[model samples]
Target: MAPGARRLATEVVLPVPESGDPVVVELGAGAGVFTGLIQELLGGRGHHLAVEADPRLASSLAARHPRARILNDDASALPQLLAEYGLGAADVVISGLPWAGPDRATQRTTLDCVRRVLAPQGAFTAFGYAHATRLTSARRFRRMLGSSFEEVIPGRTVWGSMPPAFVYHARRPRPRKSAETIDLLAAQLASRAAAATDMRF
Candidate 1:
């Protein structure tokens, strides 16, 4: 769970598109903490589709934010959900899930799903605990994140939250790299990840 600390809903502001009538997607929207914030930022402009895996949570979220078009489905079904909803690629995708908790294959699969539905210049964000970034799965997750996008920038840690967490803002999603490029990417990712090691959440 990213930024679980409730600042009475004032802790962090979910990033929204600057343009009018933008399409925003929310993944793992537990209890609609950021969902409500996103709606307020939208201010009746554009569409907000929230994907919550739990049917019970989705049902309640649907009622709480009727404007969001809540879907009780997995995040991996994002592209299909967008097509069925008749919406094009998303302008922004926000995640409230604890991404590092999953295995490598699962994380890669989910990232692929997100890449498939993001607009060319669209941005994707997910928050995680900085302290855990050094763990094996977390490192793998970070490496995959770096490879999936041309730019993967970690956001400021919300120290106000219990155990603290930070968001990752990635843009310019990239396709799978060739073997030669993969070799070079490994070097780049190492340097990038190393630079963030001293950061505190």
Candidate 2:
């Protein structure tokens, strides 16, 4: 990661809850670059999960950051992995994953997991190198984000980094009712209507 890019990624607004500590999940935590900064941000008050798909890098991350739990798994399984640790949602998700990839499908899958695990008002920050912005994968990723998030904000370019990069800040829309919840509500309404008809008869 470029120096400027690292700063941009760490500068993301972490919306901590009013009561307890915030939950942070870092994806593609390669070489522990942004790992330390995130730990400092959390200040040991909340949980930080560093996920790296490579076993060797995951082991290194564990050794370097004892305060964080290293998950040696794919980023796409973030929801399930968080559940194993008894964490339902994350307040902020900092991703260093290569959004402009060999193909867009894998990146989409990983992003879907990021959205799934984030709290309704949570923020997701990711960086893309300036040079790669013109790539087809990058363009597609940006468009996908626009459709996925309620608000998608772009940060200033970090020219200090080797190859300048910019940050993409995204927030999900307000939480929507679950399918089961809607079904239950419909059932209750139907029962109430039947009761009213029977009373009239």
Candidate 3:
């Protein structure tokens, strides 16, 4: 988390729709940085699941926010974890995970899990260093967001932190048939019409 990054995150630009009861999940919530901010914004209206992979940090997070359910698990197990709580998907998933630190495969797997666990209209928000966009992994991660979400929007760059960082917010991809499948169906329909015409002739 950056200096003003937490404030930037809580701002409306991130676009977390406040339904009557919205379910929010925070990944890599080490030391309760974003977790505190998220709790304040949630205003005790809904469930907040704070997931920290480290046992020590998870314990501390649980202590700090007793209302939040702290999960000592990996990001890849999000689907199973949500099932335990009788949730099909989360309304919002905020990630504090270090994208640049993980290997490319690990990053991809974690992102895939996030996408799988997000509701149809849910949003996913994460941050990356302002200067890191030139890096291969950062660029690759941005591309991954583009493919996964219907809309990928970047927020203001917070330059007050040590290195400065910017927020990347993504919405869930629309559920629909793929372009290839639709094209194949069209071709099949055309072939059937042609065969019918030949038979009539």
Index of the highest-lDDT prediction: 1
**Best-first order by TM-score:** 1, 3, 2
Model 2: per-residue lDDT, tens digit, 1-201? 666656665554344333468898999988887888887666777898989999999999999889999999989889999999999899888887889884766765677788789998888888888899988688767766765677888888878876777888898732333422443454566568769999999
Query: TM-score of every model?
Result: 0.83, 0.80, 0.81
Off by over 4 Å in 1: 1-14, 177-201
Model 1 TM-score, 2 decimals: 0.83
RMSD of each: 5.6, 12.4, 10.4
lDDT of 1: 0.80
Give the alpha carbon lDDT tens digit for every residue of 1-201 in model 1. Answer: 344565423333445865699899989988998899888888889999999999999999998898888999998899999999899899888887778899866887888889888898988888888789888778777778777888888877777777777778888888656322653577577767778885743
Worst 10 residues of 2 by lDDT: 174-183
Query: Least lDDT summed over 10 consecutive residues: which range in candidate 3?
Result: 174-183
How high is the CA lDDT of each candidate model? 0.80, 0.78, 0.78
- Candidate 3 off by > 4 Å: 1-5, 8-13, 174-201
Error of 3 at 160 (Å): 1.1
